[model samples]
Target: MKVVVDTNKCQDHGQCVFAAPDVFRLDEAGRLAYVSGPDESLRADVEDAADVCPLQAITLED
Candidate 1:
């Protein structure tokens, strides 16, 4: 799976971090960071993260 986030739309919120720590995280600067390509096993978690993003900045691709 491929994960994409629109930084412009993101608000440095950490919901994605809680939903999928393996693929999403908050940097030391408290900014959002994530893996673009994660293992397929993490699809569900990534999807959940995408769903929780308030700004809908997260996108998934097969």
Candidate 2:
């Protein structure tokens, strides 16, 4: 699966990190960082991250 997060829309609140730590995280500067192509086994968690993003910045492309 392909995961995309609109960084312009993201506020770096780390909600995606909480929802899917394996695919999302905060960098040393505390900005949002993520895996653009995560394993399929993490699809559900990725979807959850998309759902929980208050800014609605996360998107999934298959």
Q: What is the TM-score of each candidate against the true structure?
A: 0.96, 0.95
Evaluate residue 21 in candidate 1 and report its C-alpha lDDT on the 0 to 100 scale.
97
Candidate 2 lDDT over residue span 1-62, tens digit each: 99989978999989889999999999999999899999999999999999999999999999
RMSD of every prediction: 0.6, 0.6
How many clashes (backbone N, Cα, C below 3 Å) per candidate?
Answer: 0, 0
Q: Would you list the C-alpha lDDT of every candidate in the order shown?
A: 0.93, 0.95
TM-score of 1: 0.96
Q: Across residues 1-62, which tens digit of lDDT does each residue of candidate 1 receive?
A: 78999989999899999999999989899998788999999999999999999999999988
Find the 10 residues in a row with the least total lDDT in model 2: 7-16
| Best model number under lDDT | 2
The best candidate by TM-score is 1
